[model samples]
Target: MKSMAPTRKLYQEIKDIVLLSDHRSSMAFEVSDEVLSTYVPVAVYWIFSGIYGLLGYLEGCRLHPKGAEEEENVASKLQVLRGVLLQQVVQIAVVTLMMKVVGDEGMAPQQPSFLVCACQFLIAMVVLDLWQYFGHRYMHVNKFLYKHIHSKHHALVVPYAWGSLYNHPLEGLLLDTIGGSLAFLLSPA
Candidate 1:
């Protein structure tokens, strides 16, 4: 039908973006798209975290007095790092499982135009923000959650980039790993 022309064209453009002519040769060393998609975010997280961690050590760049911040913090830097590492391990397992369970399903088949991509990005941000807000609020409002799990993160009274992910294992699993996996699954991009 005449009405289908624009829809078909849009679909075609998406298809062009998503599907490669050759999956095996898509990358330099035959790395699959899925593998890159799976691990790149994880690698970037640690890389950026390390950068931030290093930056936090620069006394001249600090926004707050180190003595004041240190006085407020109940947990040690080592403890925070350990929590972050443990959470990252849990996140990797959850993400890998989720990817295996729903590989390429409902994803846009091709690349979208600039306008489309912009819209998708905005929508994804809003969705993720709302998801995080509600999840965080729920944890905060519940006494049990705050006392047992979320308290671990709150121990880091001095907020720093390196301590950003220092949450209890259960809280990290529920609030971050699952929320992020669901967000990725729900994203059309």
Candidate 2:
């Protein structure tokens, strides 16, 4: 077995550097890490959306400019927003179901070591990427899926941060929500 002594030492050094408190979690209110995990993704989504939205305003940062023929948006902002909202509802339902199924005992009280956490994150990324890749490819290859479902996402001519989440409700659930849930469940704690 690989010795965990070095890993523990590195984790302690990281804790000292970050000045993390053992008694307190990152949030101001007392909340379990398991519960906090659910909120983290939502927070990150908005944070990235904001960053990408800001980037859209910068000409130098844009891959395709506003006037480009190919970059024009076919779907209206309202349409995209509605799709996003619908997907969010589905996502919330899935998350609620997952939470209920897992219950309080799902997560351990002690946090995983930094190295372990990093490895888990890497694994999750690979799993999610693979899931998305195959799922998306399948959707494209299937005429019924592309026309009725995947095409909703393709309606956005110019990809923007806010529009990134705009997907058909079913497609979003299958490609994103299920893939994410699988990644979360499959990853070692």
Candidate 3:
């Protein structure tokens, strides 16, 4: 008979213990705690991204000299900064919301026979990409609406992550609302 590897033995022991344990309810809590621990750093990074983006936008606005071309360039840089921050914020918010709403013991789906989580996640990426592309294109095509609604965003042409959030209320709402709605609609139940 071949000897079992240490890791394999350890895993078997753990599996046996879990099978014998009567504290099944606590298992869910443990899993949830582990998940939270893993994601906490990601959340922190997202907050930092927002802060840095804002700082970059401010710096660009202050340092760039006064001239139409210079101002436009600075604005463009700020917008890029803002875009980075915005993307991080949106990603974090969606993950946080999903965990909060669907991560409870009772909410977890039945155990799958095969690993499908990766596939589902990929689908989510596709949906988000499509939605963002369409939303941006829509903003560019409507000049009147773009001037009033999206012009403030253009003010930071020099985009940084921080500049990402410095947009008109309507633009903000439109982007967030559309993003959130599409994410929710496309998510696998």
* Top candidate, metric TM-score: 2
- Model 2 regions more than 4 Å off: 1-20, 23-28, 67-71, 106-108
Score each candidate by Cα lDDT: 0.76, 0.80, 0.60
TM-score of each: 0.74, 0.76, 0.49
Model 1 residue 134 distance off true place after TM-score fit, in angstroms: 1.1
Order the numbered candidates by TM-score, best leading.
2, 1, 3
Clashes of 1: 4
List residue ranges in candidate 1 displaced over 4 A: 1-27, 67-70, 105-109
Candidate 2 lDDT over 89-159, as tens digits, reads 78777877887886566545676799999999999999999999999999999999999999988888777
lDDT of 3 by residue, 44-125 (tens): 6558766764564464644444343344654555445555456556656666666566566755556543446566566777
Candidate 2 backbone collisions, by pair: none
Ranking by lDDT: 2, 1, 3
Question: Comparing candidate 2 with candidate 3, which one achieves the higher lDDT?
Answer: 2
- Candidate 3 C-alpha RMSD relative to the actual structure: 9.2
